[model samples]
Target: MIDQTPLLDQISVPADLRTLQPGQLRQVADELRAATIRAVSQTGGHLGAGLGVVELTTALHYVFNTPDDRLIWDVGHQCYPHKILTGRRDRINTLRQAGGLSGFTKRSESEYDPFGAAHSSTSISAGLGMAVARDLAGGNNHVIAVIGDGAMSAGMAYEAMNNAGAMNSRLTVILNDNDMSIAPPTGAMSAYLSRLLSSKSYLGLREIGKHIAERFPRQFERAVEKAEEFARGFVTGGTLFEEMGFYYVGPIDGHNMDHLLPVLKNVRDAKDAGPVLIHVVTQKGKGYEPAEASADKYHGVAKFDVVTGAQHKPKPNAPAYQNIFGEVLSKLAEKDDKIVAITAAMPSGTGVNLFEKAHPERTFDVGIAEQHAVTFAAGMATEGYRPFAAIYSTFLQRGYDQVVHDVAIQKLPVRFAIDRAGYVGADGSTHCGAFDLAYLCCLPGFVVMAPSDEAELAHMVATAAAIDDCPSAIRYPRGEGTGADLPEVPKVLEIGKGRILREGKTVAILSLGTRLQDALAAADDLAARGLSATVADARFAKPVDTDLIDRLARDHDLLITVEEGSVGGFATQVLDHMTKADLLQTVKLRTLYMPDRFLDQDKPERQVADAGLDAAGIVKTALDALGIESAPDETVSGKDRPARA
Candidate 1:
């Protein structure tokens, strides 16, 4: 029944971990690996990373006094082991399922989690803050931050390191150099690590010098620190972090607890004050054969067979929505020289892979730095290049300030192909593209669109690319699009006009994005109860179709706006516009939007069902609000509903 094996279950807390002998640590690692495999097999989550970090997790928890010494994991993709040891083992079976544990690190989940993270490059800054706070509070606990090398490329990590070095804060950063983040990491930082680790003779000599320096007494120790800094700068061709201020350690074996424990113990006990970074190397998918063989496939997966590691995928003949976006962008770039694509180190995830391949010179991946990605796109637009800033809606939240300041304020024509723009399953609240519509819709002069199907998604992408306005965004969800045949390539949808899906009416439901299916289903069910309701896809969220919205309000007895995202999103924008136009008084208004709570994990449809954003629930809400309630023979828990497959 267990996937990897109980190398983890017998023990519960840090005290149990501390008691394990060095030889037993391997068993613990095995158990952690097995536990993670089993949990993710059932719950469907980011499995490959946790398996990769088993040894590192064991070493950190065993060697360091957790719940006393603080640990912050960047992005938290590699925290499953950390979670298991920190009294979360019992909850592991329910990982990422509805009413289950979150996939990312969450402070509310446990005391040891320290800081919650899903976004990258936040570990260093968060750890620095905790270390500084510990100092001010007179706490002697050591603060450790584990960040992947991919995250190291972000400027904020450097900012924290720079500030921490100057302040001489007691902190340690663990660089988990897997050399990959879904894909091989890019940028100067990744290249430097490769070069540094490649030259063994150079590294060996540097270590020998440090070893000899440790034997020196009193003033000699201070001299050694000074000499080491100069020698490092000279030998390493330039140390980005050490120069900024950090006691540099490693490029060590992250999976070898033998080396990790001693190094971690030394760093924890060392009287040497200020920031220290230990660069530990580990394979992304360490133990499992399939995962190690194809790390990206296992990076984030759905439920799979334990024996073969074969995922149970829904049969979709059509390509994923993101794939459609990428392919179209590639075709566009092939024809147009000015058309370029950019992603925040998420080339594949955001559907810009085609653009990257067809126009590699024009495509830029800024390495998990969304703020830089947005502003960089804005800068590119100024140079007479049309840059499609493709990014996931959740990640784009990081660039809100830049969007308002650098792009919107300057009126740059940066086309945002906002992928994964609605409820994201398995990865939970941290990954859900909940606030994008609300945030983008409110931005002055910004045009936002949510497509109903693959056809509209293609059209919207073309429309966004063609817009020379301040900024335009077309948000689409994850997974395969509805089986609708796509509209002709480069076909244009009227900028702010929405087409009505149905034309009946006691109630008119204005649907946004893929939730149009839910609206349609609800309308069908409502008709069964002798209630006819119109369904329309309100394609554009911002600069909303006032003429259509007002017409619906005047014609229908009830005007309902349904969206997958939280309330106050596109639906709220509709309300704001309707109120401004004095149209709210025209009809009884009802909005079917997700509740203003961080949604828990479940299948996407399940979460939507629980949140009352699905077909049956939508009908129920609409019927109730319409004061014409009809009792359905049966009802379903969004969770209880059979999955799409």
Candidate 2:
């Protein structure tokens, strides 16, 4: 309804954008910003980062011959505006929806994307690879990687930069410095200097200087180069990049098209310039007043009012699992001074911010470095301190090596609070936490637990704290708990144990994590069909309760194991134990887990239903296992009946 693309309507791709006059780009950037805000307000996604890069996106498309000239966005958080300008404006309203466009950049989505990204600090590496490939094929196309300052904290970015510098490939890296702390004053002087530094004439002069220096003694030649570099570095704050072997340019105003366009054109035309680093300073949430004022620049949002900027977040029926995790951890830390918290950049997302509020001295935000966070926590654990590394399950994948080498191998007592451990709806496959269970369960001497609800989460937090011998982890899902009452004081349960929720004889449903409710619902459905079902919650994936599993397998004619994870996870552990105990000979066993494919963005419930982790799907599996004939209408719940192939 609020489509405000007048000038924007004429341009469908980057080629069309190049047709526009230079002066008209400011108007296009403004319109693009408005369009991005309007679209994100309706769809509820990353707003601020996209807003910051509007002018940069417009300038790049206008100056560079994109699609032919490859451009990559690091982390892809600011790609919404880029998406709109590159033939995706028509489908902008359908962002992050089922069968619609993904929230992040995907190589399969459009030609303009060049490289796909969601996780941070990978753009330079990808761009360098493209640059080398292009050089190998005798191609002259330019490659540019746009990375944010926050993402620069990751070691991978430095590693890529170091490698790119050594390789001396012709690549361009734009460091978008949105942070106020590091950015220099961007005005006429800064713009003129950036433009001059990146110009072809300056590059030619530098090359001439190199040739002249080569004719002299090696010591004097090195001195000449240092003097030139330091003189430029004195004027512009680019000494670090220059030392790293890149021709540094900028501290230019990223929002100023006059400044951006000329500098970008200069960089594009400069021949034989190997790995140039252009430092462009911009504002996060630049155009939008509300986002500018808000902390995190309205980074991630729910669907909202276009006028008021009031986010339309659903009123929660129960406390969010994240809040519960944070609150309980904070409370635990109050009693235990040695209990410390560490999060790799995501403090609020992983509930470590709450821990920081209570115990600021003990909480550490390692900043976009998952590897460092794990190893740092392991170091703390060595000093007899209880360290809880609260990281998202998807992010924890980045630190698996540290988890195995630093913690598991050393047998450190570091507790891992893995948030978002299952299907994270709108974030799609990239952010889905489907493999933490599988990955952690396989690690020797690791205790992996998943909670059924908030109360169990609190208990598991305590359980993990109590375990001081080996590394432990508690995996929990996103969104709110199932309205389960919180305990006044959390209890530490016995490890390698499970609780039977219901008593029955026909079918035994063994559940791990949040699927316990679905298992209960399935039991009710089986009861309606004149079949009794027993439901048990196996909280721990590793050190699984073989006693409970064997009892269920032997007692029931059909045994079913359900978990909200990938293959080789909780269900695999249960199956392995059952097979080893020789319980599989008497009973018909069926395992239900996430299917072997990446699920696209959709409602969480729809994702679960499609994965056959819902109540109806469980009941259907049970009926199929027992060889019972039933029509679709006769299934457990009409609303939840699985779509048959």
Candidate 3:
């Protein structure tokens, strides 16, 4: 356990911290590291990344005029330390909780957090935009974008760099190279170059050249510039940033304050330097013993013992949805030699690592490049291989254009296993998988599916494996399965079909995804109120289960569709089919979907209830639609009967 320090107790915000001497900043960094560890041990959030950037975070705030000078953290996993320094230390323990601070950076959270970020590789673009805006407004405040080495792999970062170079925007990009991005980095040469370029002589000569260039004309400095570029290219491997038209600087030691403060001051003070890149190499989980040893496992953790570093995760009765998918996919791959699995730097998170263990040759862990991962899978599909491109639904949004252009347009047979397909808990609005169904179902020649339980997930996996003509997707939510027994031999579900779970009259409750459980609970609530309700699981979001939908519409007076996704998803598809079939004339329709608003971090149960997808909420919706007022004391299990007149 770390002891309370007088220095940290005195500092409430960065302004207070700025009054301290440069030598004293190290002490602040140490106390900040201890405080961050203690806070996350209580809150259970992104621990490793924040630990890695402690010195960098401290140095940035101390050097720059924050809140005025825009500082954007890429992916925002490393923002906990930033949050601690920026007047949020008092509420740091409330991170990722209901009515507390968010896990990621939010613009609404603080003025210091100029731009919000939860996704990877977006910092450069957002920071460049702020810098341009500042220039247009005639504001002289500096703009800095601190991004990870892993984030640089995405094409978006390069695109922003290209544009910033051309526009000659006065922006600073600090590359936080930790050599670990959820997984070990794929491109080692880029990592090596970052280390090699941090030499003292190289940085000194570069700084001298910058000063000279600012004072002199382009005509006189041409010969000297060619020599410097050649020397840099020959010895240190001229960074790709330089070729794109930005001034490149150091691969400094991020943990060393002496090195960081001076270099940062030089970069910040440099006049007319357009878009500088400072590559700083640091270790993930730098301070904590347990985290530094096993960085990946400690990246995201539940509450843990401060001394032992033992996380307090409760044992689950059933396997997680991710593990179930991996286990089933591994079994299928044993029989089918053509089966291959791909993940974009999230092998363990997506459960592709389990598949990799069985067939290392067939499993591909493409580094943080989602766009490249999608197209690479398309190429493999063209060669007659069954490729399972398992990615989180939120992360898949990054590769939507590729999904449409490469796979859908060409009719490739890439099986997309979209994990985390609904309201994911503590990660909040940014990580919620609410748009997959709406986006994928709109594309032609695609088969989209969502399972109600783990058993059904196995069946869908088999179904997706069998799809060889067109692209197919199976989306599942995060967390443990529904305690359903796994079949010895998984069955392949019929394409575009749904199954009825319960038969009734008057009202038919249709569920598209994992909300089937809630739908059934809502049925019980309706039944107790003397209203018979039918429950059906519309397994596939696309292909609408036309026959089952028609049966329900014809027999029932009211049809209420429930889904875990946002609007324009399963409910909209059902409504579209009903309108075309002219069933709206007879059946009254109501759709219960996620509200058109971004919900903050909380428990999954709370998120569901807030979204009105829970039993009580659904019951209330049905009662309101039927023009029946629900009694406050009514029971859902039919135990307490209301006297019928």
Against the unseen true structure, what C-alpha lDDT does each candidate score? Answer: 0.81, 0.91, 0.87
Query: Positional deviation of 65 in candidate 1, in angstroms?
Result: 1.0
Model 1: per-residue Cα lDDT over 1-645, one tens digit each = 344454565688988888868889977887787877877878777887788788999998888888898989899988888888888888888887777788888888888888999989999899889888988998888999998878988878888888989989889888888875222333345434434533444456666777887888868877876776776655443366777887666556777666676667767766543687776778877888888788384888888888898888878877899988888878777777989899988888887777777788988988879999999999999998889999998999889899999999988999998888788887788889888888887788999899889888888878887888679998889888888897656687787899897887577999989999989998888877766788999899987888889889877777888887776688878888888988866777888877788876778988888878889888878778756556545542223334322
| Off by more than 4 A, model 1 | 1-9, 180-226, 233-238, 295-297, 631-645
Q: What is the total number of backbone clashes in candidate 3?
A: 0
Model 3 RMSD in Å is 4.5
**Can you give the TM-score per candidate against the true fold?**
0.88, 0.97, 0.92
lDDT of 3 at 472: 93
Candidate that would win on TM-score? 2
Q: What would you estimate as the lDDT of candidate 1? A: 0.81
Query: After superposing candidate 2, which stretches have Cα over 4 Å from the reference?
Result: 1-4, 631-645
Better of 1 and 3 by TM-score: 3
RMSD in order of candidates: 7.2, 3.8, 4.5
Best-to-worst order by TM-score is 2, 3, 1
